[model samples]
Target: MRPFSKSLAVQIFVGTIQRLPQSARPSGIYKTRVNMPVYLNINGFEGDQQADLRVHGGPDKAVQLYPVAHYAALIKRFPELLGKLAPGAIGENISCPDLNEQEVHIGDLWQLGEALLQITQPRSPCSKIDEKLDCKGVAAYIAQSSKTGWYFRVLEPGMVTAENRLVLVESGNEHYRLCSILSLMQQNESAAIGALQRCLMAPGIADNLRLKIEQKIVHLNRASTGTP
Candidate 1:
């Protein structure tokens, strides 16, 4: 398939450290941001670090992206979040316009600066976001709103700045959009069997996510046939 006609990078952020909350125990949340002109490799930004490696910062999740457009609406919903939430607040490395869950598909390849990237999967919104916001259910809100941004796997590593434009050089797995996959994963209903199956076969999908889909397919099949 052809690349999306346009994709723009509004800001670039790299994590500095995982910060513990002011009046709470260690949160393991990377709440700091780094300067631009950062190095991006298969592992992730060179200076960045994720407190929990089990759920973040791997080859399949080299880069985290959030749509800049989602910020305004989110701020309106939670006024307290107006100043607290900004680019990189949710652990995203790149903030972009025009790239949302609906339009970006798994396996889509992009050219950014001198590097190549492939859309791997949607970022599974976690409880840490709520902890960061000091408001419960914010993570669920992100999921329900479908504003949860997606992740990118580095195909070729290079330096990237905030102003570097994102060019979609290749499109992958048009059979499933990132939002649809996130919906299916969240709902896990038998109605999404076809989508789940396609996701399992889709190239560049994370192994853990693929396994989850496989399990869901088995569960759905057993339920449909009333098997034990």
Candidate 2:
């Protein structure tokens, strides 16, 4: 088995929520970065929200949670020592407990121990990061390189405080990691279709993601396979 990475905590600030559009948002969550325990989960996405946890604090943005960075300037100086196989597939010296279920695939969701949360999409780097660092397009660099962060879909609504054990529950298709599958999907439509089909068969995949996959399948089949 591959060695697991370590998990880190970052405190969230409450002021950031003011920037979000109010909808499906629970009032009282903080916006500042706070130290919260992020663990590996079987959902194929890192930093899963627990079923018994209500997002106590996060940006009022659509997905309320803090996104950790995969890139660290500290390791860039020693890329040769890092043995970066694919630049950003996994960060150098990755230290987090985010598990991708048994297999880790796209459109996968997992329940925290018993019932906690549903990790869905990864936190792709955005322009907002550029301002944070005063560097234009830094976020784009991390995203293009595949160091995109992760997020969770709230389930089993409860409070998520610091020191949460963040149990890993297996749900959806635990076969292919989302990043790997996405890479394949972009190249070979046939393989992408197969992967999407596999994801379709997984238990508890979110309908939105599934629909997106299906749409891609339809478009790709027509473009690459010449669907009749």
Candidate 3:
């Protein structure tokens, strides 16, 4: 992997619950850029909130970082989303350039201003994304491309501002890059079993993700053996 810059400039975003006219369920996907400093805690930014706590906010998914580069590619493929999909449109808390899933490992740690953040897992795209963007298959495309951004768990909470940049303080399992993990997930059990086994051994993996992988392995084993 190539060396990352000492500090990568970042943009911070946050949102509250909002109910779109077309959807009955409220969502926090409509985020706006925060120009001032905000407190970062174990749960998330001070002003940030998710409509569904069951799957969105938690210690394991305190922050979401999306690459700005993705916007251009997305718009190119989905011209209809030209003005609809942009930075902060996908509920990403941190928007940074020159960084994507390919460059980040599962457990990489970074220092953002006064807070320490560790990557736990890739952000699982949900149907809410399609509703929010008013474009079908967008979420599925993100998953297939492995361009889906990853999540960060705050290791040390503190005040942070858009002026602050991300600095890599530590690296995690190189073999378990986010892109590779997502790719493995898209594969069948027979094709992904070996890599899945190795991924579970990686340090700093989210508890929920580990459980999911373990469960998948169990299901795969049963299927392979022709057992119900």
Candidate 4:
């Protein structure tokens, strides 16, 4: 594992569970920027809540980090969303400049303030994004573009704040870049089977994500052999 030489500033955000007025479904996507320090535990930051534990807010998906650069690209793609979308628009807990899917790898570990965090997997964009942004196809656009951010699991809990900087302590497999993993996930052909297998073996990978990858490989193998 290699150490990241430079540290990047972190902007923190957190939100509580709220019911969407349109769908009545509970969501934690509407985050507010935090100027003060907040405690981060194995589950997540204090005051942050996930409506549905089945899909969000666990040890594996404790914190979500989105790149600030992607917001510019998104606005360029959808000019109408110029004012609607920004750093915390996507429900990310952290926004770091120049740190997108391509720059990070699965299983990478970083120190934020006094806490330790490990990159687990790329966040899967859902319909909630469309609802939150009040625009259709935003979720699909993020998924297709592979601009979807990634999640982090807390390895050592401590207080963190926007003033903190994310310093890489340990690097994950360079072969399993978050962008490549997200791309491979969208490809179901036999050609992607091998790559998917290797991604599953990456250290610090989220259990739920690993299970999904394993299932994809099984499906691909079955398709190639005409077993179904």
- Report the lDDT tens digits of candidate 4 across residue range 1-228: 777766998789999888876898999988999999999999999999888789988999999999999999889888889888878988999988868887889999999999999999888889998887778888899889999899999999999877889998888777789989888888979999989989988999999889999999999999999998
Instruction: Give the poorly placed runs of model 1, Cα more than 4 Å off.
Output: 3-7, 22-35
Per-candidate alpha-carbon RMSD to the true structure? 2.2, 9.5, 2.0, 1.2
- Which is the better candidate, 1 or 4, if ranked by lDDT? 4
lDDT of each residue in 81-166, candidate 3, tens digit only: 98787789888999998789888898888999899998999988898888988888888888888789989999999999878889
Considering only N, C-alpha and C atoms within 3 Å, which residue pairs clash in candidate 1?
Answer: none
Model 3: weakest 10-residue lDDT segment is 1-10
What are the runs in model 3 whose C-alpha is more than 4 Å off? 1-5, 189-191
The TM-score leader among the candidates is: 4
Tens-place lDDT digits, model 2, residues 1-228 = 132223333232222222213333322222233354333322212332322123221321123232233344313633532442222222111223343222344333333323344445444444544443334555666556555544455544444344444444543444546566445445644656776677665444445556767887888788786776
Q: Please say which candidate is ahead in TM-score: 1 or 4.
A: 4
Ranking by TM-score: 4, 3, 1, 2
Q: How well does candidate 4 score on lDDT at residue 15? A: 93
Identify the superior model by TM-score, candidate 2 or candidate 3: 3
TM-score of each: 0.89, 0.55, 0.93, 0.96
Q: After superposition, how far is residue 131 of candidate 4 from its true place, in Å?
A: 0.9
Name the runs in model 2 displaced over 4 angstroms.
1-15, 18-31, 35-69, 73-115, 226-228
Kindly indicate the candidate among 3 and 4 with the higher TM-score. 4
lDDT of 1 by residue, 126-215 (tens): 887887778777788887888889889999999887678898887766676887887787664578798788888777888877887888
- Greater TM-score among 2 and 4 belongs to 4
Ranking by lDDT: 4, 3, 1, 2
